[model samples]
Each structure stands twice: as structure tokens, then as C-alpha cells.
Target: MNTNSTIRARRIADDIDALAGITEPDRPYTRRAFTPKFLEGRKWLEQAMRDAGAVTQIDAAGNLIGTIRGAHPDLGTIMLGSHSDTVPDGGRFDGIAGVIAALEVVRALRDQGTVLDHTLEVADFLAEEVSIFGVSCIGSRGMSGSRPPEWLQRVAGELTLEQAIADVGGHPLHSAERDDIKAFLELHIEQGPVLQNEKIDIGVVTAIAGITRIEIIVEGRADHAGTTPMGARKDALTTAAWIALGVEELAKALASGEAHFAATVGEFEMTPNAANVVPARVRMLIDARAERREDMERFVDELDNGVGAIAAKTGVAVSAPRMVSDNLPTPGDADLLDVLDGACQTAGASHRRMASGAGHDTAWMARITKAAMIFVPCVDGRSHAPDELATAEDIALGAAVLLDAVMALDTKLQEDI
Candidate 1:
């Protein structure tokens, strides 16, 4: 790596560390979406962007856009961004890591005092945690125009999309367009154990997983436990447990390393909380994910079949409806991947190309523009927890790679024009 780049990387890291230390610290920087602390963090980030010598502005959707205007007006903007909001009790590193890294990248570019071909922008997206709305990536969804009109009417209580936008200080008409940029790059920590367990410093994410969520309800006759014989009585909880375990088995059967097929039965509830009463109803949520659309569909099918078989054997009624199937698996940009890989190699950071197991904001941006994500290792593969963390050096290395990738894209756009 060149001395200029190394110096720039270190400077950006220093800036990130400083910003992370000062942000809305209500109980150690636990800022949930739309809360007062989250808003404070947003304000601090806005000021930080302005102080970094960038033109800072907020979009209708509460996305803080920090812009370094380019000399070539014909070239479209190139953006580097991530969400600043956190899940409840989430680790400080999850979303803020990306936002701070993006901020530092733009700041570092300004400190380098170089004019770019395409405008450089850093965005701190809002409401990414889904803690407030129960749906993740709210900011990016609005910006990408992927939020269906039906969703606006059906979900999020009685508040329409227009009302929600207005409440959050955004305009609906402007929220649905994507006229700004040619491409995007996001830096984040690998929230899983893949990179850390593999002892890899960086991950070039090839695809973000597509999620399919289902709410399953198993209904059976409520009866007295003492009077109802095991052979005669229908137990909803027992049947639900069978289906849940069956779902895991099916996932194993469908597992092809190519798609990384996985299913999780993360939630379960039993009705009539009493030791003497049989559970009349059991409600469970099954989350299915895969790298490819076909695989995700197969997962859904398997889940349906599993529930069906269990219901038939146990004499329990089963009903499952998909709640969310936002199945857009973001395929990373080929050129962007090349740039990221090159950056990793140049920085002497070992990287493995892998698909992200979890969804991220980049998945939504992929619909409108060329987009990709770079991931650094998280300690013990932990994320979305208060203890989740990555070493400072690892964070710096990831930021350095992001800086190089952004610079490469900036120069490429100039050459194209």
C-alpha cells in the first residue's frame, strides 16, 4: 500500500474512533430507531460530516448525505454509506461501524485534497434496525422504492407511508426516486463467525441472503392433561416441536454449500400457560434464508411440507402464511468486487469471497445501482449484542480497503467520461 493511502486510512480510523466515543450515549450508545438518543446520534453525525469539509444534507427519508462535489458534472455520484441506527441492546459496532467508516472515508478523501470525477457521498441511513417498525432496512427500502404501496397501507399500523414519511421529516414524492448515483459501497463487520473463525481479515461479500418469514399456527383441542390420554389427546405444542425440528432436518437435507441453505425456527408460543392444561394452540415463526431465489423457495416448500406431515400425524390443524418474502438477493457488482479484492490484496489483508448470511442495506441499493459490501471480522462471530466487537486494527484495515475501493471507483468513472 502507498504511504498516502496508509496515512489516509489511519486518519480515517482516528476520526471514526473519536466519533464513536461521543455519539448519543444513553447507556453505552444503545440507540434504537427514532428514539431521542438515535436522533441525537444523527445530529452528531450531521455535524461531523459538515466538519469533515463535506456539504452535509438530509434527504426526505432522514438519510444524512455528506457530499464532496466532483469536478465532472456529467459523471454520476458514487456513494459510500451504511445505517447509523442500532437494534435495541445491540452492540455499538453493528450499524455504526459502517456509518463511521463511510464518514471517515469521505473525510479522508477531503484531507487528501483530491478532486474526484464523480461526487463522493457518505450516507447515514435511518431506521435500519426494524426495532421500531418490525421490518428491517426501512430507510433503504424507501430510498430504493422497493416498499410496495400495499405494504404502506397494510403494515406499520394506521400510519400510511405518507404519514410515516411526514412523521420522520421526509417527503413521499421524493422518497420513491433513485436519481443520484452510479454505484455504492458499504463497509461493515461480519456479524457471524465465518471470518473470525476462519481467521480471515476481510470478506468480499458476493451476495446478500434473501429472507422469507412465515408465521405458523398449530391448533389442537384443549383438554385436561389428567383426563386426556396421550393416544387420544391432541397437543399443539408437541406437534409444533416436531415441525420445528423437522424444519431443521429439512434444511440439512436441502443444504448445498453452493446456496448455503438454512432455516431457523426462532420463535414459539404456547397458549393457556398451565401445567395441567394441554396447549390448544402454538404459534411459531420460521425464518428461511438462502443465497439464491430458487433455494429460498425450496426452503419455503420444505417448511410447508414439514408442517403438513406433522399436522397429519399429530391430528393437529396447522396454518402457515408468509409474512415477508422480500426475496431480492443482491448480487454484487463485478467491477466493484474486483476493486475490493484488489484493495484487500494491496493492503496485505487476506480475504475470502463469501455470501452474506444476513440481509443488509446494500441489498436494497442493488436494485437501483451497482452496489457491494466489504466485511471485516467481528470478535467471536458476535453481532447485534452489547458484547459484539472487532479489534481496532481490523476496523482500520477494513476502512483502508473501503477507501481504496471508493478511490478506484471515483477514478474509473472519471476515465469513462
Candidate 2:
């Protein structure tokens, strides 16, 4: 596996088949964020990061950078990307195979001429899926300034995440305060099924769960389904289906065996226009996660006391669980997970570590710096959708361990600064 790693794994499978043919071939690989086929797949990945010579841009929260420099460009930068949007019939390699394996690790360091000393960028971020404004790493939370003025007054297609960060050229009140990037790698696609059920070929990660979400709402009293009899009916969709089966039996009794602790309700809604009316109102969302933070505060306090005892035995009137987003657990950076487990044993591959249960932009670029990730192994682990596969030899062995963990985090982050 080295004719320049089979020509960068056939140029990352021909740049993921030309960014999955810039989507919208009448749906099914939709490419959501800012739409128009996600701005023509971010203009074909910003012209494949300017034909791999780098030096591109789009910041101010639209995030599409590129750079390349290195050679002590004032020692700092060393990012890497992930996010080409999708999730609505999504998955052409979840975040487009971590933005084409970080532009094939800057086209394999400009075809091995090497360079390094730091300064390497590569991003692609914007709307890391799950957004119609219900935010999801919207451009790594606006380049880690952590954008949240009500997430620029939420919108999505009709724009207004500050007009989709100034229609992509970005500058929604400038925010690239880069304290010399330092470290940030990414290389996704382990959407789950733990390295193809442990056949393993790389997945270092090690923590990124934290999400919360919530919403709830129940109400009731639409009535008249055959003159509301059933013992004086009130049923807000049967008390939101008994609070979605008590949020899957309180996340399987608080993951008694810790199956990566989770809780979901996915999303449900029911109002007047139903096969029968008696289903006054119901709207759930829930979606908790854990990897600790006191097991996401005891699964949102046992799902807010089991939705107040299923809205007081189904009389209905819930509403009170509304923490729409939390985001805690980010971890991953014990020296970038030992420089990605020594870049998967120096690319001989076969790795393990794990954690990520979805949610990325390297968990909001690990809130500013030294982030990490590098999965690779999707197939039956599936992803947002369109049968989300992965295997141009496990995404070129996770982009050759993300080009040896970005040249060992650009020489171990300049010897720990």
C-alpha cells in the first residue's frame, strides 16, 4: 500500500466520486446546509482546495479554509476539516469523508514535497448537518467563538445564520481570531459499528458524546374522537406514547451496563390532523447522550421525572423539558490521543480507542484547539443515510492515518510549545 499509498487511494476515490456528484440528483444525498446542493458541494470543495495548492478561505463562520504554508508560519495552525453537510437523505460519507480526507491531507503534503513546521488548515465546516437552524456545529460553532446569538436567529434555507454567514464568503461580523490553531485533525466515518465490529482499521477518537437536546411539550384536549369517551379522553398522542416508552425505559435503566449511555425520542409530533382527534398536542425531541457529566445529569433527571409521571398519568400538560442543546463531553486530546495512537502504529493500521456517538466538527474543534478524530469504517455502521458506505480500502486507511496524524501533530505541537 504505497505507490504513494496507491495514489492517495485513487485520489480519495476520485474525490468521493466528485463529492457524490454534487447531490440533488433529485434527492437522496440531499446536501442540506445553505442548500443549492450545499452550494454546489461548497463549490466542489473550494476547487478541491484550490487544486491542492491550498490558500483558500471562506471564514467568518461559513468555514471553508485551506491554507498550507508551514515552515514556522509563526508556529500554530494545523487544522484539518470535516463537514460538507448532508443529513436529510444524507450520507455520501457523512461529512463528505472528512472533507475529502482533509483534502487528501493537503494532497499528501503537496505530493511529498513535505514542508511542515505547522500552518496547514483545510476545513469545510458550515452546518455540520442537523440544522434548519436547530444548530449542529454550524461551522464549528462559528470557528469556536461559539456562535450563539440565538444561533444568529436560526433559519437555514431562507438564510440567516447571519445570512448563511454572508452567503458563504463569510464575515458575519468577522470572527477568525485564531490563537494560532495548534492542532485539530478530523477524518470521520465510523458512524458506528465500532470499526466494522472490531475488524478495526483505525478509529482513535476517545470521547465526544455530551449532546442533550430535549424539547417535550404535551398539552391535550382536542377531543371528539367518537365523542371523547374512553373514560374522558385527554390523550396527547397517548401522552406522547408514554413519553416515548419512558425514553426507552430510561435509556435502558441508565445503561445499567453502560452501552455508551444514550436516550432518544428521536422526534415525534401529533396534533389535530390525525386519523382521529383526541390527540390534542404532542411534540417531542429528546435525544440525550452521555460519556459522562454525571451520565448527562442522570439522563436529564430521569427524563425529567419520566415526563412528570407521564403528565400525571396521562391527564396531559407536560411542557417543561426544554433545554434544546447542551453539548458537554468533548475530551480527546491526551496529546492528541498519543498522536492518534502513533498514527495507527505508523500506518500499519488496525486501531481502536473509540467513543464518538455522532456529533462532530471535532466536538466543536474540542472547544478551540488540540482536537482529534479519525474513524473510517462505515458500511453497516451506516451514517445519516443513502446507505452510507466507506471503503476505498477503509478510506485509504483513514487517509493514511490522516497523513501520519498530520505529521505527528506537526512535530508534537512544536514540542509542547
TM-score per prediction, in order, is: 0.91, 0.36
Candidate 1 regions exceeding 4 Å error are 1-3, 6-26, 150-164, 320-326, 414-417
Q: Model 1, range 23-105, lDDT digits (tens) per residue?
A: 45455546776566667777788888888878987676657788888888568888888887776666478877788777777
TM-score of 2: 0.36
Candidates' C-alpha lDDT: 0.77, 0.80
**Cα deviation of 35, candidate 2, in Å:** 23
CA RMSD per model (angstroms): 2.6, 17.6
Model 2 misplaced stretches (Cα beyond 4 Å): 1-17, 22-24, 28-94, 97-103, 106-112, 115-207, 210-231, 238-265, 269-276, 280-285, 302-306, 313-330, 337-357, 360-371, 374-405, 409-417
Residues 1-417, model 2: lDDT tens digits: 333442377788888888787788777777888878888888888887898898887878778888989888888788888888888876688878878887887888778788898889888888877778776777787788877667787765566778777877788777754677878888888777867877888888788888888898888888778867798988888788888887888888777764367788888877775676778887889888877788779878877887897788767788879898787888788888888888788778878786876778888778778888878888788777788788877888787788887887788777877
Where does candidate 1 have its weakest 10-residue lDDT segment?
A: 1-10
Candidate 2, after superposition: displacement of residue 369 in Å?
A: 20
Model 2, residue pairs in steric clash: none
